[model samples]
Target chain A: MDRRDFLKCSLAGCSLFLVGKGLSTPLSSSALAAPPSQLSRVEARYYQKLPDREIKCELCPRFCQLGDKERGFCGVRENQDGKYYTLVYGKVASLNVDPIEKKPFFHFLPGSEAFSLATAGCNLSCKFCQNWEISQMRPEQVRNIHLPPEAVVETAEKYNCPVIAYTYSEPVIFYEFMYDTCLLARRRGIKNVVVSAGYINPEPLADLMKVVEAIKIDLKAFTQDFYTNYVRGELQPVLKTIKQIAKSKTWLEIVYLVIPTLNDNPEDIRKMSRWLKAEIGPDYPIHFSRFHPMYLIKNLPPTPVSTLEKLREIALEEGLHYVYVGNVPGHPGEHTYCPNCGKVIIERYGYTIKKKELSGNKCRYCGQVIPGVWS
Target chain B: MKTSKVVVITARNVFSGQGLPDPRVVLKMFRKGLELLTGASKAEEALAIWFKPEDRVGIKINTIGRRLLSTLPETSITLGLWLGQTICREDNIIIWDRSNEELKDTGYKLSNTPGSLKIFGTDTRGAGYTEEPIVNRNIGSLFSRIQAELIDASISLAILKDHGLAGVTAGLKNYFGAIHNPNKYHDSHCNPYIAELFETDLIRRKHRLTILDALKVQYHRGPSYHPQWAENCKKLIFSTDPVAADAVGWKLIDELRARKGLPSLKEENREPVYLFTAEKLGLGQARLENIEIVEEEV
Candidate 1:
């Protein structure tokens, strides 16, 4: 439809609400709160101060060199008066208590709840972003709740959550706040898990690894072209992050959303699985989630369930042990089967643990030691 | 189909003694530029070509740079007044940016009087972004309701500055204020996204004209102001073809950089290549060969 006709319809929709107040004076809303402002005085590591007040943001592969008062590509970190500050530090836009299974960490404590939080702004602009309302906005543009580090730990304790999950939007954008919160949560014996696209530089990732317990990287696609066109980022750095996690003590899991025409080729899936087996070993779980048509990518339809099942078959055929399907509530692919005994060990139905046949960390049916952090 | 004509009008005394835009000269520049571009004998005739008496005209200004560098109040007010006198009523014209705070910082009175010209921001209480995303090409953004719903027509009255990424911040880049996520499109020097955004029905179909306020141009190291690199070019550019207008603005910046013995935008690896992308999409002519240059002194 034409914009004019659409606008006319919109105005007509609001006409009934306009009757309460005269159009002369606009209603007053509350003034914006600047308490958790962008004045994060925390000293940033992994950056070099250039000549003439410009600083290169080495926290990501983009390495955006910004001038005074300019923000980096993330829209969260800014160079204010020649220093970098993460704008979304302790500025939570969305917070909820979700099952650890929802983060899809089949290896971690299955039924436990993780206190999840996300802030405004992301490092990359994915065309099919499900959370674009918050992720692709400046901190000032969104309504943020001030949940500082201590409050975060307190909230987790209050909810009886054993873990704090940094999920929803990109956690790398709120690096400082997540780092500090991880430290606080760790001291309180609360485990920390990160659900990220894993688009970060090495030095900062190393620092983050020292605090968080488990990391779930959403490897968006296997190709650099897909990363360039859809995600507005580079694929190499994300691959680097996965390799880094494999080398570290942190439990690592990978999620790849299979968007039908975009990134769901069986050959590419086979290549990625083979690469993962060679580099990180086949123990790490890889979830090929279903992609919904969202944000700018509404022209295309969602990935077919059969396509996801086929891709799962390809990954398994390529010597990967733990391969699963996501976003489909009750498909048989959601269950974890023992590679040794071929029996269903963990049956999942939409983030809920329907059945568990594991005795401690070993398979109850076959007595094979499963490669997972099943406490 | 016939292509649109773009006019470039310059004035000698665009800057007043206090070292900002002189309102009187800016009005004259807008008048003559619009008149010549639209091929109208009078200023009112040019304005009547696009707008009607009952229209609510939105003057979308750029104020992200705050007070130090922004679309000066004088240029925007002069256009608002001219628009108020010609096609729309005074109250139907609104001068706006992203926020009331930025507007206040850039020296503007926040007004919403019934019969007077209204001035406010997109963040003004009831005026936030649209809940749904407008999906077009690779540009998916929640438009500010002020631009998408509040007004009937839009005038991109923007500052012409050398962008640190886009190479030029003129009329086309000004529409970034209308969308919620401009920071995301800054990659690859804002190539296809800038063009694709302008092609969106939210912007392209409603955009009536482009007026670039270039009285004091920040030619280099910009989008932010450094007084040392600023120059008083004292000019305003008008066009219906948005790409052509920005193309001229890019040339002007290159000229300034050359005069100062600095590198060209291409040499610096930040050229405004988005114009070519826009041209390839059939938005407008970006090359100098196709654009008919018109220079007038007001």
Candidate 2:
């Protein structure tokens, strides 16, 4: 977002924030550096204490075993004197009331406002990270507002937001803070949702699925080579997360950002669509998001609308129930259609839900049951 | 083949008991190092061989371990002051690390004197990291302005220690402190990324020296302080070839580990092959056979 847009978005009551000064220029990162006073020393979860003041983090597949003063790949958790601590426990880098559609949860709550928040630092270093200003930084390198779990719950309640979103940066990195906030938000009659890279370990993912109502996993690519060479992560763990979430009662959605000449191959999309159909079944919504020139991958052009359309067609042909093309507003792919009886069940323009013709869980036109939480 | 030279200097009585290295003896070691490395009669004349009067020299020290195990203030300041008084202007040399807090924790009083030997960190207001990242191979990191824009030449004045992750943390690994994202590079025994980071023009072009402070070496369970595994090695290794300097330092760590009946870093499967990667990049020689070791005790 630009400076003007940031100022405009700050109209949400009782909220304060500071974005990087220059919109065109990259964040000096100096602007993001939080003072020492803003730091949190909260002991972390999902880590094993090893001998001699060392630790091995099991939060993710990396399983980073660190000596004292060492940090995991995520850059938010650290091993301080043999105990693992989450430096960004309550440090919120970005907080705003965003449309649930922005998270592209077309199936889950089409038009509801979400209290979206994120902390600095992400586990995966995607070469084309869209939110690198905050995601690709240590807690000390970002300006953070100290909003404890109670404060987060209260903020969502005050804003009249039905759902709270752990998003922007990878939510799994701030699992402790997010999990605590989720528990509090749930008690207060609010729903909790997560937007993540799905890079979490099975134990943590299993635990997280029990607390959150829904999850949006950004499946970077179908290939391990893409995960390794570009995303600096493993593909199997992400696939496992999808499978686990599919087995759970919690709502699940998948987004595949198609970067030009990167992960946009037709063959990979066919394989991914077939796999999703076989494992998660045809009910789960899959989005083919358009990739822009961002972070370190600025040289490539934005994903062509033709590419998104073609991929959407491929997925649809592969028998996936609901496939949407993202990042291009007003495209037919942005709207929801009933797979049982083809009709526009929910028309959307950008983040705005233009029209909804659904009665409970079924399409109003054909009495066909379209999956998702509509209440 | 022109083999690299590594000078290992020691003073037996430099630390008879628990105290910092004796400044007088340390100065003699530095003098001998420079004279022998450059074939000069004095240290000041030796500095002229590699650095010009106009160059701003940055002595990048590893200060992550706090007071117990870090590049001590005694070694860095003494060397910075000597370089200022001899080769460059007093203000031209900056002894720096990642942050002011780490520097302070390592017993360094933050200084930003415009016309004196300065000792501070990247967090010292104007010395923060650059806005954009310098991309080279697998390394995409924002370099501290101290190493990128402020200094014309660089020195990795690193602590010699056995790293749990990198197998050894020395000259090449110390450059990790110069970047904003060292944590990202620590994967895979810090291979290729360490070498690639050192190959970045911001580092490779400016780096002029490598000095490993081995007064007290942590032979095992380190990159952290565990007195049981640490040894008072009473040594300082000097070399212009960074890979060779760290390779020699790695050999010392393994030797100490062997003496203490501990398995090698390789047996533990965390060997630092980045030196070999660095050697492949023509940064320096990694093989001991290709490096000449010169020992001295002052």
Which candidate leads the pack in TM-score?
Answer: 2
CAPRI tier for the interface of model 1: acceptable
Provide TM-scores for the models.
0.91, 0.96
Docking class of 2: medium
The number of the candidate with the highest lDDT is 2
Tell me, per candidate, how large a share of the native contacts it keeps. 0.35, 0.47
| Model 1 Cα lDDT, one tens digit per residue, A50-100 | 876778999888899888777787777877777777777777766777788
Q: What is the lDDT of residue A273 in candidate 2?
A: 92
For model 1, the stretches where C-alpha displacement exceeds 4 angstroms are A1-45, A299-302, B1-6
What C-alpha lDDT values do all the predictions have?
0.83, 0.88
Per-residue lDDT tens digits for candidate 2, residues B1-298, read: 5499999988887663458877777778788887777677987888887789899999999999989999988788889888888888989999999888888888899888678788888877777778877789998888888898889999899999998878999999999998888889888888888899999998999989899999999999888899999998989999999999999999999999999999998899988899899999999999999999889888
Q: What's the CA error at residue A345 for candidate 1, in Å?
A: 2.7
Q: Can you give the lDDT of residue B27 in candidate 2?
A: 79
